[model samples]
Target: MIRRLARFRQRFGIAGRKVAVRTELAWYWRWLGILVILAAAFALAAWMYETGRRFAGFDQRELQQQIRELERQNGRVRDELKGTREELESLRAATAASESRLAIERSAQHKLAQQIKLLERENARLREELATFESLLASEARVSKPLSIHRLTVQPDVLPGEYRYRLLLLTGTGRREQQFQGRLELVVSLTEGGKDAMMVIPEATGDAAPAFRLSFKYFHRVEGSFRVSPKAKVKGVQVRVYEGKAAQARATADATIE
Candidate 1:
C-alpha cells in the first residue's frame, strides 16, 4: 500500500511533469493581430524616411515650386524677345520703304533737270534760226555764187575722239530753180606723235560714203558726226561741198577747234 501511494505521488508531482496554462483564440483573430503589427512597422519606416530627407535639405515641394517659377520666367523672356524681333522687322521695313521713296524722288528730279536742259537748248536754237531768217529777208543783193555755206561749226562730242559738225547751205536766187544734188566732205586737221596730219571722213570706197550724199533746195541744214584717233589733238576742220562728177569743191567752210 505504501508503494502504491508513492507511485501516485510521483505521477502527480511537479518535478515529474510541468503543466502549461493557455487561452484558446480563433484563427481570424490571430491573423488580425499579425496584420496590425505589420501596419505599425510600415508607418514607422515611412516617418523615418521622410525625416531623413528633410535632414538632407531635399524638400520636394519647394523644389517643384522653384521649377514652376523658372518656367514662368522663361515664358516671359521668350515673349519679350519675340516682341523685340517683331519691332526690329518693322523698323527694317520702314527703312527700306524710306530708301525706296528717296531713290524714286532722286530719279524724278534727275529726269526733270534733263528735260529743262533740253528745253533751254531748243529755245536757243529757235532764237538763232529766227535771227538768220530775218537777216536773209533784209538782204537786198543776191549771192553771186550758186551755192554758199554759212554758220559752219565743229565741236567735240561726248565720247573721246568723236566730233559733231553742223552747217547751213544757202542756194543763190538763180540756183533755187532746181534741187541741188551734191555730196559733203570733211577735212580733219590734227596733230599726232608731234606730227601734223589730215584725215578725210567717209574714206574712198567706204560704207559711210552713202551718208555724205546730199539733196536739197533753197536752204538746207547739215549735221553729222565723225570719229578719229583718241590720242590725236584736233586743230581745225574744213567742210567742202561737191556737185555731181565735179573734182573741185563748189562750196567750202573752215572752222577752228579749241
Candidate 2:
C-alpha cells in the first residue's frame, strides 16, 4: 500500500515541485472597479463646473460696473440741460429791460426837440418886439426937443365946400416949464369965379371964439374942418400957430390938398 501511494504522488506531478496557481476573479471585485471609474469621472465633472462658475462671476461684476458708469453720465447730461434753461431765461429778461430803456430814451429825445423849437420861436418873437420898441424910441428922440411943426396934412372933406387939415406942433425941451398957450389958423387957396382966392379956416369970426385954441407942454395935434364958398375949389392949405391969442404968428406950415 505504501509503494502504490508513492507511485500516485509521483504521477500527479506534486511530489516535491513548487508551482504557481491562478483562479477566476470574484463578481463583487468587478463591481467595485466600475464604481471607482464612475467616481473619477464625477470628480472631473465637478472641477470643470467650479471653474466655469468663477469665470461667470467675473463677467457679471464687469457688466454691473458698466451700468453704473452709464448712469453717472446720464446724471451729468441732465444737470447741463437745467443750467442751459436758466441761462436762456436770464438773457430774455435782460433783453426786455434794455428794450424798455431804449423806448423811454427815444421819447425823451423827442420832447427835448419840441422844447428847443418852442424856445427858438419865442426868442424870434422877442427880437421882433425889441426892434419895434427901438424904432419908437428913435422917433420920439428925433421929435422931442424941437419947437416946430413936425407934420402937416390937408384933405377934402365929405361936404361939397369943406376942407380938413392936420398939424403936429412940437415944443422945445429947453422950455418945458414955460407952458405955451396958442391959437391955430388955416389959410386955403381956392379957385372961386375962375380966380385964385384965399380963405381962413376957423377964422376969428368973433373975439369970444378965436381960431382953434391950442395948449401943450411937449407936443400938440391940431385938426380942423372948415367951409368955403360953394363955388370954391381948394388947392392948397397953410397952417399958422400964434402965441397967447395974438395975431402975431410963431410958426407956419404948408401942405397941398389932393
Best candidate, lDDT: 1
Q: Candidate 2, which ten residues in sequence have the lowest lDDT sum? A: 133-142
After superposition, the stretches of candidate 2 with alpha carbons farther than 4 Å from their true spots are 1-146, 205-211
List the pairs of residues colliding in candidate 1: none
My TM-score estimates for the predictions, one after another, are 0.65, 0.42
Error of 2 at 231 (Å): 2.2
lDDT of 2 by residue, 39-121 (tens): 99999998777668767774555768988998899889889988998998898898899899999999999999999999999
Best by TM-score: 1
Off by over 4 Å in 1: 1-59, 141-145, 158-160, 173-178, 193-195, 206-208
What is the per-residue lDDT of model 1 for residues 197-219, given as tens digits with 9 covering 90 to 100?
A: 99987786633377798888888
Q: Looking at model 1, which ten-residue stretch has the lowest summed lDDT?
A: 136-145
